[model samples]
Target chain A: MIVGDLSRRELADRLAGEGLALQFGPFNLRIRSNLGSFASLAHQLYEPYPLPEPAAISDFHVDISAPRGLRRWLRRQACFGIDGQLPFAPYTIEHAFPALEWGINWCVATRAHHLLLLHSAAVERNGRAIVFPASPGDGKSTLCTALIHSGWRLLSDEFGIVRPEDGMLLPIPRLIPLKNQSIEVIRKFRPEAIIGPSFLETRKGTVAHVRPPVESIRRAQEPARPRWLVFPRWVAGAPFTLEAMPKSQAFLSVATNAFNYEVLDEIAFRLVTEMVRSCDAYSLVYSDLDDAVNALDKLSQASDG
Target chain B: MLVSPLADRLIWQEWDDIYIVYQPAAAATHVFNETTVLILKCLQQGPLSMEVLRHQTEAALGVSQDELAANDFEFATTRLEELGLVEFVDDPSTAQ
Candidate 1:
């Protein structure tokens, strides 16, 4: 069963009561929200993901609700809490869905110590994956979004969940939030893309999200062995340029860019060491999506040959 | 200065001129640049006076001793000392 199977009223009833349990890649997430806006958008966007069994255990239990008392009427806000703990402050009601999106990232970044989690984007092609570990505003999401839309499979848009036992990247294809100018860039680029409502003037300026392709959502359980590590940066008016990066330099960048590398320590060290040794690394600067995608395609194709 | 017992327990890998050493005592991985790598390699040969270590490091780097300041050698050794990876057996404060 999927979210789409449930009618609007049925989904609302479930959310208003217990929660809606859904499988997101490797984990089961049980989401509860009193905000009707969040439910509607969630239903529309998460339609492709499968529903978890009612008896199965959930990895995360989160809730988003409008606070009661004067604040509800004075200025509406949506609060995200997990297991009775509020991780961050409330978002204005208009940004309720975006709040839910960011809340999911917070949960994984803070928890999931069992996996070597990286602040990165992972995309796959022909069993080979490229992990782009980068800081925010470095065009990680933009490049990931473009690649996934341009025939590459979206392993993940935000979290690079690396299984420590083996260096394979576990797929956790979630929504890609395109901020400000990139929103129009993607909208014009991929008309067929399923996009959620734009939340304007929130924390990240005007923001919109592009849904993960249905195929990626359906094939969420499949993990890919990484073959490349590309750090992408968006440079306006600059031509597409890809330079080979040293494995040692790549190792340092990946270790520092990870969300919890120090917490995992030795295990993290071994995984990164092994991963960097096996994969080719590059630094990419680009302005145009078409040219960038072509260059990446050529890179993978050369490796395949 | 001689490498400490903790330094002997270091888990590390070298790629080209770069080396990343993980000190189990500090639970910290240190990434050493070329000069630090040269200094570490020189110290790995056994205990040496500051003058000897500096000469060996400069020789390996192919830079004349009179040209470059021995700052990197001082920096690397100072860092190694702070991390308990090395210790001064002869009180280098008195050394020129």
Candidate 2:
């Protein structure tokens, strides 16, 4: 009900008293729950404009208003109506909106034509996209946060939705979630960065989110051709390094890490093959953000040269 | 009926300019260039004999018979068959 115009606190109260209704780009969602859990649901379901303060109280608890039996069914199926089509899962109440945004990211990812989802972080500057596809604890987010604060545009902090049809990296940039030392590391690097509240003792070890820069959000529709595929690893006390990886080996690495690669079938294979062929693949190991940024800058300059 | 029946079993995927398709269980793989995807999509409707495939491909892709030959259509057919996407179909009239 014209929900996008509401302020963060008003939106929170409205969602609590009434229900959750909001739109994110192309998708719209409505959730009905009691006041107790509505706060969490609200934060998760909507991207609070002019992002709320770090210590601001975020209400994450709400009670389901549906009948006991229907509630059980909704949970069991994990399905929710999106634009009237029942999606694979409901957007459950997350402690932070970033988590819910990630769910929305997953939702849009499946609908793209022949696009494979990759567990990576991508950032762009001057039309060139750099993808860091890696597993959890590989320090991709930390690297991405560092890059964005250093003037790179964040494409996405998690999934690298690569369209197989055109080999373009679609922008699905959201808040970059950081954990434990990464949060502190980024704070030291970019003190002005807007960070969400940290959910302590989470499975990912005290998780927090770095708000994506506004420029990235403004250019959300822009698609960039991947120029570098860097698989980063955080190694304590290691010198900042970038090593070239073989194309054949790089192909396997990317295919295995891709989210919807297998589902996209032949198109997935072709897109990845094209991407790997065109971009220079490297393995980056670092313990310091400054050193890593310097190394990336050198690479960027060389490409331009 | 003109396309190889074995072509049905083949799995082909092209991304950008590079193409790779293979049958793992059959232990066969084939690679093609940008032109192969157009060829595969044409054959996807059903198996076609080599002559018919060539003629249809010529019409669909707007290439001359000689140009089609230059693309190594015969080699592509063999590769597709090896990948199990196309196969030989018995002509019913001949059998009768």
Candidate 3:
């Protein structure tokens, strides 16, 4: 029937069994999968917009009818609709939802406002927000999980959605995905934390999502002005260290990590420039999550003071 | 013929006092100052005739008539074009 009538789980099942039918913003996507590598396809379809472009338009639908043998063995399969023909065999909705999410984000971003998506997690404390931006495997998620458990509000784990107009971060703190060791690290750190199902042997080793704290989810609509930009690197045995970064260097580092910085062109530049200017930038390297959290707490206190 | 070859195929975006131009395929981003930012913004909506661009820039910046036509405006526009910050769209009817 109509999308409004079906629940997310029901829609997901329909897409997995018969085929998925849902509208993401302006684009209506329908996917059919056999439940094998369909999850992979869903991820691709829903992956965040790589570059800010108009919402993708796909009218001609594809029929991906896969044989049992192919379905059971396939790790991932994807083929676009060409001319009027469905390029390949059946694909499932599990793989398509993630792709739609990403595509919808891209479409909304490009049309409504330029978003500078950063590879960072943000949290709020006492009316001020702190952003932890670091490369993958830097223990950012681990630190973020610890802070949230300690009463800091989680803003996001994978993305830092910054509005180009005011440099305010839009808080859509969803599940914080933790990889391999970090998952165990967080598990040990916050015994009460509820972690999602782990997808073992996937591309990024053991991957599981840490559910956002209930408070964070409840305050998901609260946008925060960034007060600190800390680039964190997890060093196994090193003591906690915090160093101020030059604004120029911080500017370049942040721009390099920004998702839609280049796409937004001048607006992105100004927004980021203003953001970094208004916030304190630092390099935070630590081994222990407790120590890292302490140092951040001190930093935020000093900033507020 | 007066067009600086540098300004071709460039797209400029302005935010407040900052102006930035990014060449997508080239993966290059250049930042500009307030004056240049305003100049780029003047050309952003669509290509305007140089005369119209100059007047608009003057009005936006609140420059006097004499200072409006000064060498600074011409020099900045030339340098911006040289740096691949603006472009000329060929209109057959306007072509001399």
Candidate 4:
């Protein structure tokens, strides 16, 4: 049954007790939370996700709840726990949603070593993927949001999971978290974009999440051949420009941004080398969202020509 | 004296001017720029002494002898050793 099949109260009850099992691409996550706000948001935000069969084993068993101690009495705070160990300290209850989102990301980035995990935003068009490997605050999510809405399919906003055996980019179409001013920027740029509640004054300043387009979620199982490796940067007042990047530099950028490049060792090395060799790599700098998306569209079109 | 690359543990691939090396002994991957690729290629074709290695790499990369400083050669040798790619060996006759 899909997660939406559960009533809000039923979802809350299950989350407070056993957990809600949902699939994200190749991985299964069993999320347990007693926080009503988190549960309600999960119901809405994760509605597109499929509920795995009851007997399926979850790859990560995650929880976000109040710690049992003085903090719970002093000020209700939420802590993220994976398999009973808390990796992050508690934040105010209001930050529960972002905490949950980040907790899952941590689970994937830290554990998934067999696959080449890149810190990138990926989108697809015409069965080919364009990977944007960049550090946080490089405006990747904003660019990703614009592209997905402008006709491209979102593979992922935080991770570009490459299946090593086949060299295909797996789709993990989860919610894209928009931080600070980008939230308002995306909202004004695409008023139709569905944004979740904002959590103020956290570590990343004000933050909100935009739901993955329903089409992206619907096509989440489809893997795309990587055709372009573009490093995108959003510079203030800069005109849109795309420059061809040397494959050597592209290799370094990807190696540096990869989460498990070293852990995967030779497999990671060959995978990245082949990816750079296969793709038309570029470094893109742009200020206008429309221009950035157009530049990417042209790059995607280059695959045909 | 001939220097041999650590053949048992080291693996590498080249793309254009870039080469990525994987050393199973260290379970690490190292990327070499064009210049480093030239240096490594010289080392790969049987091991040569620091002097011979530097001369061959310079000839291959079009780098003049004066441009290739002693410290630069030492740095590359040390880096390759650290990556488990190359190592210095005493002359066989001298050892006997």
Q: Pick the candidate with the highest lDDT.
A: 4
Q: How close to the true structure is residue A142 of candidate 4, measured as C-alpha lDDT?
A: 97
Poorest 10 consecutive residues by lDDT, candidate 3 chain A: A45-54
After superposition, which runs of candidate 3 have C-alpha atoms over 4 Å from their true positions?
Answer: A1-113, B1-96
Once fitted onto the true fold, the runs of candidate 1 whose alpha carbons sit more than 4 angstroms away are B1-5, B41-69, B91-96
Tell me which of candidates 3 and 4 scores higher on TM-score. 4
A256: Cα error in model 2, Å = 0.8
Model 2: DockQ score? 0.06
lDDT of 2 by residue, A102-188 (tens): 445556556544457887899888889999989989999999999999989988888887866688888766667798999999999
Better of 1 and 2 by TM-score: 1
Give stretches of model 4 more than 4 Å off. B1-4, B7-9, B33-35, B58-75, B94-96
* DockQ result, candidate 4: 0.55
Candidate 2 vs candidate 4: which has greater DockQ? 4
Instruction: Score every model by TM-score.
Output: 0.92, 0.64, 0.60, 0.92
Pick by DockQ: 1 or 4, better one: 4
Interface RMSD of each: 0.9, 6.3, 6.4, 1.8
Per-model lDDT: 0.86, 0.68, 0.65, 0.87
Q: What is the TM-score of chain A alone in each candidate?
A: 0.98, 0.77, 0.71, 0.98
Residue A71 in model 1: lDDT: 86
List all candidate RMSDs to the true structure: 2.8, 9.6, 10.3, 2.3
TM-score of 1: 0.92
The interface RMSD value for candidate 1 stands at 0.9
